[model samples]
Target: MGTRLQNKVAIITGSTSGIGRGCAELFAEEGAHVIVNDDGSRKGLGEEVVEHIKASGGSASFFRADVFQSEDLRKLIEYATETYGRLDILMNNAYKGHATSVLEQEEADWDMVFNSSVKAAFLGCKYALPAMIKAGAGSIINTASIHGLLGGLRHSAYASAKAAIVNLTRQMAVDYGKYGIRVNSICPGRIVTEGKIEFLKKYPEEVRRQQAVYPLRRPGTMREAASAALFLASEDASFVTGHALVVDGGLTAQLPDSVAEPLEEGLGLFRTE
Candidate 1:
């Protein structure tokens, strides 16, 4: 019912749940015909999302594809253009990675992470850009992460892939701007998804530890992350491009809690009770 993306056509990969689904639902709610995609890892879930959208009176459908494959990405683009006659928004949100250091990481894992995160974005643009160029305008949102900016302790592969995406987004914007295409990435910090809920439940200590670093004292919700995507996808960000808008709940804006906590205790910082 929002007009920000009224009548626009969008495709979001990895949309069975989490940030992908969040964007899919919100984009539909804003009147964009959304293509909710999954890697077939969650077939029923993808259909459930489409049904949810229709029930809510938003336009959406499901598309299953493995974004890591160039061919699959091409087909996805074709589906969007054939179904809707144009592609207005492309959000590459499908990702897979693990907490493994260089010493502990396997070559296959590294490649998988890169293929899922970086190559998929590349392929999405490769196929979607032509459709967008034909129309002379489009918005592409790549999901980077705070780990991409600050790097991660154990998230080496995922972080590296995200960093590549951040730069790739810039490169795409530089090359595609002449065609009126805007490319941008959002670097989210700790977002509260179902995975995080389970994580916190199992490792309860992380709850307080997570709350300490962020000025907001909490993790971000999917809706909040989706809102950031919405801004970059909609014409609201018409003048924005090649930007990595950090949505980290102020995590990157401050010192690490490990270092700052003791300093806080001594300096009476945040001591007000």
Candidate 2:
């Protein structure tokens, strides 16, 4: 069979690296023309991924813009329509600096997080929805986190923003479903990427404890999460919309009784794939 995304035009925000980068690469590999948006920093991950896609015989281009700004978002959307003539997939996958608990989070910090995470998604949908509506069908995939589905310590702003994204997904589905646009959110669990791996290295005990508690007894990979995103944005999930697909390696599924036994032994459910 040919690529699942052949001839499709996609816009993936914050795709300089990490999960967003993976999505951009995968989409381009499957034959979609991708617009990689980032802050245009010379050292940004977006440029790197664009290079990766181009080197792999895929078609992609980069746009430097801050996702938090409405103008920037509008520009990106307009660029897609003007250049590619249609926008098929819109993936909101950008995040910025955040810190500990709500008490420690400043007003500026909170604004920064919300603008980057929640506001960005809102603007992406706001601008891209019309194109989808006109085209008669499209996919909008918001990158949420397991924290959005449940509580976690020292992640108030990120959690709140992500929770908003999940709700926004539902609301968009309700409002735009009639227009043939499918909206959904993906809640990714603990996945070991370069940043996370380095962060975890600073806390060996916590990493070990997390590994033990996960049913898979390990963290996930960026590519695995990207694959799930692909499925949501593809015709394979044509009938699926307004859903929060949690890819947490069973971490969120571990209940009190389920974890009591494992916790007692300093291990988790330890299931295999």
Candidate 3:
């Protein structure tokens, strides 16, 4: 019921859950006719998302497709333009990665992670760009991660794929700026998605450690990340492109030991109270 994206058409992959789901709902609420894409395994969840959108007075439909496959991605783009008459935004938010170091990771695991996290974005842009070129204007948002900007303890494959996406966004922006297509990436920090919630339940101590590092003293939410994507997708960011907007609660802006507690009592560098 917002006019921010009134009459626009958007396709968001991996939109059945997590941050992608947040983008799907928020984009639809902002007046875009959304194409909610997810893999066939999550068809029921995808349909549920569409039903929720409709019930809330928004326009949306579910399209089940494996984003890693070029053929499937091609159909996804076609389905959007054919259904909505034009494509205005494309969000390549699908992601899958293993928690393994470079030396410990299997070849198959590396391939799968790259195909899911990096290749999917490449294909989404590849197929969506032509339709956007015809429309004379478009927005493409890629879901990179804070891990892409900084190193992670045991996330070699995920970090590398996200870094690739960040650069890919820049490359696409440079290549297609003349066509009026804007490309950008969102680098989110630790967000409290369902999976993350479960992980935190198992390791409550980890939660405290993570919160201490973030300047906000807490993890972010999917809605917060979605808002960042919305800004990049809307005309508010018309002049923005090739930017990796960091949404990490200022975690990367501080020094590694800035959040450390004082060794002696009443000697903290920065008082929390």
What do the candidate models score in CA lDDT, each in turn? 0.89, 0.87, 0.89
lDDT of 2 by residue, 1-273 (tens): 239889899999988878988888888888899999898764656667888899998999988878878998999999999999999999999988684697898888888989998988998889998899999999999999999989899998989989999999999999999988999999999877767878877877656677677787777899999999999988899999999999989999878687566678764344322
Cα lDDT tens digits, model 1, 211-269, are 66667777899999999999999989999999999998888887665547744554333
Q: How much does candidate 3 score in TM-score?
A: 0.94
TM-score of predicted structure 1 = 0.94
Over 118-233, each residue of candidate 3 has an lDDT whose tens digit, in order, gives 89999888889998998899999999999899998989888988999999999999999999999999999999987899998897766766666778877899999999999999
| Worst 10 contiguous positions by lDDT, candidate 1 | 264-273
Q: Regarding lDDT, does 2 or 3 come out ahead?
A: 3
> Judged by lDDT, which candidate is best?
3
**Candidate 1 local Cα displacement, residue 125, angstroms:** 0.5
Per-residue error for 219 in candidate 3, Å, reads: 0.5
> Quick one: ranking by TM-score, best first?
3, 1, 2
lDDT for residue 115 in candidate 3, whole number 0-100? 96
Name the Cα RMSD for model 3.
2.8
